[model samples]
Target chain A: MAAHMTNAHRRFLQVLMSNRITEGSEARKLHQHCCETDKVYYAHDKLDDFISTINSHLQPLFMQIRKGISEDDGRAHYAVVNLAETEVTKMASDYTEMELELFRKTMDLIILSENGFASSTDILNLADQLKTKKMKKKEAEQVLKVFVEDKWLSEKNGEYTLHTRCIIEMEQYILSYYQDLAKKCNLCHSLAIQSQVCESCGIGMHLPCARKYFRGQTEPRCPKCNEFWSCDTPGVNRMGSQT
Target chain B: GKEKANELHSEMSAFDSTAFAEDLLTFMGINRTEVEETNDSEDVPADFLPSHAWQKMGEEALKYFRRAPTFHYMMGSFKSESPVRKQRIE
Candidate 1:
């Protein structure tokens, strides 16, 4: 039988529902706060177990509290997922048909690109081409801003990539949909959107994972083929440098 | 024992459904008195009874709450193009 849900679990679920996603450190803090406030047993190392208890209750409702590591930084994150809905209907309630079309096109650009990013200009150009309803450049820009604010996408230097939460939730869907096109990181074995592709073998590894693997080596070599790893070693302080 | 059962029934009756319904209407930002007055004045259908209307509102609220998207669900929603988004223009 699953662990019984307590006031602490309910409190945590409430906060998570409102925030949608929380980073590892923040989740831990929230875990501690919930336990203390509810006068439940609190343990620093028991956050995962605490979440599992909540997940058991949510299973009947077709929801789950999922944990995943960020491809950009390798930091852990928690997001609530809906297991019942699929594809368009999942988001149709919040976004219009045109907006959904734009977002899908944006995903195509990012996922199919070598660097797993779509430039702002490229994404903006698709707005007018949307099949459902053409969106003006200004309208598309506003929608893009909303996407970022809602944490569906993250932007850097005017380039857009899927948010960590998106990757966590859609990993299986993306893998199945993209088939050979979407590559998984050989190291972590998870979907790698922002990754370095091996020139000879075509295997991919997330930048953070590659950094960790090649940290002390004199010359980085492909773990699979043992060939020279050609990509520039991402700097320690550059992206998700924290161990 | 018979007196105790009667006392329980009286206590239960003291909890007024109309008062509770008015409180719910106020919380939901609906003016129950205005609705009641309109129903009283107009040839409103039986379906427009205050209790029925509030019950409908409650069902709608439940639907909205249940459909509220989680962060993961919200992001996963944009994969409409599926295998690939077609090239719109050459």
Candidate 2:
């Protein structure tokens, strides 16, 4: 199907199919290329045609992003198509024991506290919390080191938050025990039923809805949750399942 | 309460937050340069927050999260989201 698309149209589709939600500067790029008949918006007309065609093909996967969450810090957010969420339901054993422990620590912190990101200080302090076979502050730091290196969690601007990969991959584990999923998507009105669920607060929008929300803006967020809609569509992630 | 504090403090020497990030940088093969670190200062005017210092260090260590680990994922379809004890198609 991509064979027929002009180079401009293909480029737009490549960015659109990205696992990451269309938001922030990425949102601007999409709109710039899809709208504005001027040469600045590369495949303007062709992108329109492509979205219309591919939107329905991937609808079951919530490929269209029509909504967004805006945060208090002043940033736009868009939920992307979490293509891996439904494939596996648990943290697969592919991780080493130490890796698993770090993942658990993040989960504990997030679930125990109503807040989303786990401050690095609090996590390192876990060494203090441990009474037995304790991780030296060095060991504790090592644990976090492994986590950051592995993409289980992400650190940005001095805060550590569970990556969307971990959140969506571990949604069952994260939400099943704690956190209520009461918020609903304004665009689709669906229960934010899938990976479109918010990381900070439980809210979401279909991928297409999120993309559309970013149709022209630099950063469009989920108005209800106020989170910078983000996803890492860098490569394939087989994800976890029950042991 | 006293016991908890002791347990946590006992770990002070074990978890040097700064050292941890520096070491992690090496482990991840990030090009790292040594910076002079000083820990000895003596002048008794009391406005020190030890926890804050540690907290700040913890935040500093988090910048490397973007270079997270990569995994080689395999592709295969699972039969179900739950385990079933039924007959096999094999």
Candidate 3:
């Protein structure tokens, strides 16, 4: 059964399968292997591929991998988390009203902004927009801690970015509950928060551009996805309706 | 819950990309210990179970992983009661 494996892959399998088997020698071997991989993979031209390989192998096992540098240690690190034991699994659904309020502010900073990373100060400053009596910087700091520690957000050098876990686990909620105010126009190449969206294919176009595109079509369709774009909505025929 | 977890275990256990990951590790002359997890926790909640479609996705993801190493961009649905991503009810 192990005939197909190269010696290295077999060694890795031995390390993975060791937890169920024995203690002392296996532990030493596992540590040795981890260090070898760290030196070779992290420092080589294979950085991205090495990360990908680890992720692909463990994803089926329900392991979540993250890259971070702890502020306390200031050393870069990679972590593997068990999804079943992780509090991050349903954290979005478990948000308190206050947490959700802060999440809204975070959305404005990360998703609605030109760049994805938002400084700690930006998150704290957005607290002013909250309807609550006072949104002090201390409160934002605490909320950011919750977000980072719980793995909902990934922080680097005091700038926070969305994690892949959040994207995968919260796909539907984000698509349905929130509008992408930062969508860039395909034609004009600028943010088009108010663009009409195609429900079938989920693309956006400026209403004026859509109107011009659909001018002569008896059955208008999205140029990108070829999905039917209905013109029946309010005053869709108003281009020549004044006549 | 037990049934869904079992189903997930069955689905997940069918594909092993560790060989491919290890191949890349070997190619880089990195003799890493296999840190790949082998099983999902039996206590996984029903709500946390992936959609029924994940079985197929697992196969596809494995296929992609075997050809190359990047599977991070592959998406799996976690929507509750979503039409295309309905979780196994039973």
Candidate 3: Cα lDDT at A56: 70
Task: Choose 1 or 2, whichever is better by lDDT.
Answer: 1
Q: How well does chain B match by TM-score in each candidate? A: 0.26, 0.23, 0.19
lDDT of each: 0.80, 0.47, 0.51
What ordering of candidates by TM-score runs from best to worst?
1, 2, 3
lDDT of 1 by residue, A65-168 (tens): 88988887889998887766554446546787788888878888898899999999999999989888899999999999988987879999999999997787
**Regarding TM-score, does 1 or 3 come out ahead?**
1
Better of 1 and 3 by lDDT: 1
What TM-score, over all chains together, does every model reach?
A: 0.72, 0.36, 0.30
> Cα RMSDs of all predictions?
11.7, 19.6, 24.0
* Candidate 1 TM-score to native: 0.72
The per-prediction i-RMS, to one decimal, reads 5.2, 11.0, 12.7
Write candidate 3's Cα lDDT for A1-243 as tens digits. 112323444344334332222223333455457648644332334433444555576666775444432222223334344444233343334455555667656755775544456788888887766654446788778878877765567788998866544543343344444444456455544334335677777677655556656766666777888877754433245334442
Give the interface-residue alpha carbon RMSD of model 1: 5.2
Model 2 / residue B63 / CA error / Å: 29
